[model samples]
Target: MTQSKEIKKPSSGLAARIFRQQMFIPLAALFLLALFNFIMDPSFYRISFDYNSVGNPVLSGNIISILDAGSELAILAIGMTLVTAATGGQDISVGAAIAISGSVVLRVLCGTNSRPDTLQAPIFVAILVSCVVAMLFGAFNGMLVAYFRIQPMVATLILFTAGRSIAAWINNNELPIISDPSFGVFGGFIPGIPIPTPIFIAAGCMIVIALVLRFTNLGLYVQSVGINESSSRLNGLNPAFIKFLTFVVLGLCVAVAGLIKVSRFSSINYSVVAKDIEMDAILAVALGGNALSGGKFNMKASIIGAYVIQFLATTLYKFKVQSTALPAYKAVVVILLVVLSAPKVREYLARIGKQIRQKTHVKEAG
Candidate 1:
């Protein structure tokens, strides 16, 4: 019996360690969501091979839809995680920035025509131009926050308010449609590919960021600056540049997401494209168990949290919830998650756990 008790101790300790990890919350949430869906409807887990309109074989079902739909949010969450880590605040302008970027892509592709029979430039060129434009705007916001010491939210609000207008002006308030079939491949499925193109794009972005973090000191610098700017400066780190760089990185993410958005429709709607997506991205960061106030962060957790949010949204839609009411329902869940993830709440739970463990030890002794 004593040998069995000793053997169980290591496993229990490992479980507790995992429970206390930053990834635990998002992983638990994902498990709960999966379990709930399984209980409510086993069909939700079903995946089947199907042909799309273009006669390409594709996977279909709730899980695939969640992964496909979550791609953009996941990409955005990667950037948002870095920004939140460095600036200690969220960027509110990403959705609007996407509009501007998508508009630029259309403008370059159409080349003064609202409806183009053929692309004026290569798709890659249009994407490159839009990427540059997005980075410039990101720099603008970064300057305000990093150089002038403005709050991140307030600095980004400037672009959020006028970015759509700027996007409209880029193409003279015209909505251009691309007739080229190749453009659609970015948002849809490629020839002979079963998975959605957006999934590949998101995966590529994840790989790039992971490599950057692995090969460079960018992650450590961002964390150091975020935790204490003054101390970081003393340690020879440039807090302002680190903060500025994060916003620029986020801009790159916005441009990629915008590309996916416009390619999906092969056009742009100035007012409606990517609307309120910034909020979802911010919520993803929060749900990852990362501190909004800034410090250490877990990029993997934020990415998983993005999928969890998409999972919840898809589940609600499955139940036929009204589109307008989705935000309210999400808001309630967000409140619960945020409160449970609070530091004080975690501390209280830990104290209770310790007490329980002590009592169990005493019982064993008796």
Candidate 2:
């Protein structure tokens, strides 16, 4: 008789996958909050279609609105994920960078004085100029962090403090408007489409990032540098170059997000274009279960975290909570999730579980 070896079946369950990916806490919190909202108001999950004042078909519902409004944050989180992974630092100047980019768009659309003559500027020109300027700004930050070895926060803070003021100078302190119906298509919806265009833009950006990371060594290099810069250098990877490129890519994200924001209103306001959004983007990256100390990262988790933050804020608003108090509510939920996901807490739980199993096994044996 021949001896046979037994093969075990692979575990493929939702719980197993969640645990394996370390996403159990975030996913569980997401579902719990969603269920709570649904229980409080059965209509919370309901979606309905309607027409806007312009006679275009539109999606009208809380969930739709949340995704639509959260697109910018989602986009920013993608860029933030890369920067955090490569440089082990978050860009706090994203809002300012976008403000500057939006202002560049405005200057292109309406010129220095924001006159109708400037409206003749081609939309492509405006977009291109904005992207270039944003990239330059990003490169500036990258130079400081990569070449000068300055702290990422301190390097970016320079732009953060002066960005809007620079925007004011760019437009000569006058608001610039695109004044084209076509411009609204990017911010709102295409003709005859019920979905918001920003959603598609965000999705497209995400797909591009995923493809780039999937098909190239860029992701590997980033993580390697993040984990150990000296080791990466020894392996022929240029950490400085990688870090610089990360910021440049993030600049692209800021440009795209700024375009959508300005397109939404067809104008740029230097004072409030992307104010305070940097904090939210950073929070999204952190909440996505990425270590702020760098090393490994998951863009998908950051994306989910972006949606979670938006959903939490939306739900809070639905519950009649004051707008000012929404941040506090978010803090409570985020704190709970973080605590539950802490390594120490998980290890303690595992110890207790093992003890229970041991006791049960002993009793069964007896």
Best by TM-score: 1
Which regions of candidate 1 deviate over 4 angstroms? 1-12, 360-366
Over 1-366, each residue of candidate 1 has an lDDT whose tens digit, in order, gives: 333434478876777689788999999999999999999999999999999887999988888888888999999999999999999998999999999999999999999889989989999999999999999999999999999999999999999999999999998998898989999999999999898899899999999999999999999999998999999999999999999999999999999999999999999999999999999999999999999888788899999999999999999999999978999999998998888888898799989866777677787789
Candidate 2: tens digits of C-alpha lDDT, residues 109-167: 77645656437678899899999999999999999999999989999999999998998
Q: How many steric clashes between backbone atoms does each model show? A: 0, 0
lDDT of 2: 0.85
Among the numbered candidates, top lDDT falls to 1
CA lDDT scores, all candidates in order: 0.93, 0.85
Which stretches of candidate 2 lie above 4 Å from their native place? 1-17, 115-118
TM-score of 1: 0.95
Q: Tell me which residue pairs clash in candidate 1.
A: none
